[model samples]
Target chain A: MITIEFIPFSQMSGLSTEQKIKKILKSVKSDKIVLLQGKLKKDEETELIKLTMSMVNEKFHGIEPAIFSPEIKNTGNFLKFLKEKFINMLLSDRQGITLVGPANLIKEIKRDPEKMQLLLDLNVSRRKKK
Target chain B: MLDKIRSALKSLFSGFFKKKKQLKLGLYGPPNGGKTTLANKICKDWLGEEMGSVSNIPHETREIKIKEQILIKSGNKQLTFNLVDTPGIATRIDYEDFVKAGLDEEEAKTRAKEATKGVIDSIKWLDSVDAVVVVLDATKDPLNQVNITILGNLQAKKIPVLIVGNKIDLKRADIKKIENTFPQYKVVGISAKYGTSVEDFYTELFNLVKP
Candidate 1:
């Protein structure tokens, strides 16, 4: 069975970049998809990918990550855009949803400004059955 | 009149002595998207030297390679810069994928490890570059996450970007799809292998790095 875990921003608050990555990686390694309450900082995202690479093994492949920031839709409204940008600067964690899943389980994560489509690898279930 | 002549001479002498800051131009994209091929082509055209090897296997470039002081002449104007060819960025790397590409299990595992480091290094190098050339396969779907992530990061950093739709020699190549996918950036289509439309790429480079 596929497991999805929601991690609110409060849980990730006050954590260092490495700690946040470790927390996410721990869940991914356990075969659970992580639904993070807010997006990671740009550098943290890169670090997450880097850490994920080092931990790649026979059992754990890696991660497929996608972020959906609400600010993307506000681009058309100049005042709204400025307001969102200002708010983002004040907040410790930018408001958004970040999805991270084990690469072995998630085939693809297609994203646009409006929505995200997560495609699962049906072959994984077939292998499990065998 | 004498003072004006002295001033003119001083200006000319200063222009001759002043060195322009070398622009760092990076080639980035997904694995097997012909980034190394284009780097080699650019190097050969100006310096008569190749930067790195090329292979059909993905992640052939597992480390960042650079060639310095490449001067390209277009008409009477010349542009010189350091060319950085980075390993392709990907969301995932699997040793079994390498094994399927003809590598032994152990070799595949090692390659995968190096490739992961390569991706990290590529992302880090984004901070240091002045401008970037996003090399992509014209034949493949241009809307993949790897391409989006690379472009998004570049955008966030406000780095000047020029997209190159490579491998136009192939029948399946579709530069239009890439152009439509990214209407915000300038897209140039070329076959980095056969040197097709490469001159146009050089012309675009001049515009891309204009101060």
Candidate 2:
């Protein structure tokens, strides 16, 4: 089982997103298995997507939502895409959870229907990691 | 083809029985946001009827409800409100029944898993309605995702919206904060449980919609 805990920048206050995620993965018992995807080097997106798909195929459903940064480009968008990919793989496959950002942030995004619509398409909320 | 003919016949006859234009207006908000309560108050005081059902549970309204509605005009020139109530958006809906609901599900779920599928569906519905009555719960944290989404999408689509901030009877209800957060909306606070401010709400609604 995996849990994607969104570290809302506001909640995390001073820490950078990568720092918070790195700290989380570092503190957690899971090994190199837990991913850190926001604002990574450009070379990382493909690897992150592949890693996430592999994890889900292994049935590593998330227990909570993963945190992301809006400042982090497609970090949140990518997670949403990952959900579509996972469901495409499972086809009524067991539920999986992947998070985009914190609730408050999601609320902010909600103000922009176009972006929020994208997030819904991405399945960032209900998909396993919040 | 045969079904539509039967439907038109049914409506033609029922129209005589009901004798109302049945203006379709939507009462939309996030889950547990007192949309049903507001709908109930309108049903009782103005419509002179009982509410369909009111519950604290989310997703209680998964489909639309039509009424033998009425339009009461004020002393002004001409205005009326024949209302329709639709399901609240945040409530987890099983669109699998879309076919029964008169739509094809496979085509709809094509957008499934997209974060804003919920928002997209909502935008589409908002367009169908003449005007919108946005409900907010004054008793809870005024800022919520569903309201943000509902209001934002409404604004994006330029749908006429009236913000209903309900449950003012509760001690914790803050009318001003809700007003402040959603300044873009024409906000009103109502104690739907007691029927306070409901008349004015319908009165305002009467002025906005078509007969």
Candidate 3:
């Protein structure tokens, strides 16, 4: 059975933020894809890339979440690392999240996740207009 | 036996008469840096509630998430501290996380820009703060654009800043290296997971606001 945990924002209005994050990182069902994005600083972006790789490497049913970092000053060395991992992660300052996995899991997330979570934890959805 | 009962009754009566005070404190750090965990620990310890969520997912907090006033004590005085948690920040920018969250192209871009603005605003929140605690992951190095920018901003505002080197319990945590990097400030190395060194951290922070 698929496990879905909701982590509230740091405000602590509801779910646990860290547990929510861990769930998002681990909540890959089948062939659905994930993209984690934001205007993150250089270090933050690098940290996420590392987190995503480690999380994906674990046994979550044969899923791989690759990162494409921002543009690097020295393109040669950067490209070499990306090619090694089969991902051209440039290592820039922009914070982004990418997830590709099963469609059913994505649907379940849409049904239960919060808006701020959608913007912060999952992906940002455009539906609620107010 | 009669005296013991009388004393117990007096103590119980005084417990209800105790006054509570709250202090506002801000928790700042980059995305996925474990700032939320530290915040929750302080709150739950004092206020009986979790500080905030600790997540490995970047940008787990997209806005300035504020916790209610937490009543903590400093010496003979009891004060309530308001812990403010904010979104994770970074230099490079991307909207993919938004897209994966299921946003359209135009809206995702707008939200990305708005969230970036929020992070910038949170950094400036340091200026008016009573005191600021910067959470640096011990598993990572100290040098980065966001770190430098934040430190520079705090110094410019003449804010009393404390460095919290969290996750020191991790095997790869290089606490000494972090201290050596930012020698100009007060740094405390602690493992938030084990509750080690938090007392020292709290004391150091309490000393600044003790009135």
* Full-model lDDT for every candidate: 0.89, 0.52, 0.57
Please report the candidate that would top TM-score against the real structure: 1
In model 2, what lDDT does residue B59 have? 43
Evaluated on CA atoms against the true complex, candidate 3 attains a DockQ of 0.02
DockQ order of candidates, top first: 1, 2, 3
Better of 2 and 3 by lDDT: 3
For A1-130, candidate 1 gives per-residue lDDT tens digits of 7889999999998899999999999999888899999988777777887788788877788999987666444657899888767887787464878899999999988765566789998777578779
Tens-place lDDT per residue, model 3, B51-146, is: 555555456566777777676776686666667886665533355566677778786666556555556657546655766788888898675445
Candidate 3 wrong stretches, greater than 4 Å: A1-130, B1-23, B74-77, B97-114
lDDT of candidate 2 over B1-211, digit per residue (tens): 9999999999999988764444567777765567767777766755678656775544455455655454454566444454556655541233333334454667433322221233334444666776788887887756644465566556756768888888888999988988877776678888888888876776667555534
Supply DockQ values for each candidate. Answer: 0.46, 0.04, 0.02
| lDDT rank order | 1, 3, 2
Better of 1 and 2 by TM-score: 1
Stretches of candidate 1 exceeding 4 Å from the true structure = A71-94, A113-115, A125-130, B1-20
lDDT comparing candidate 2 with the true structure: 0.52
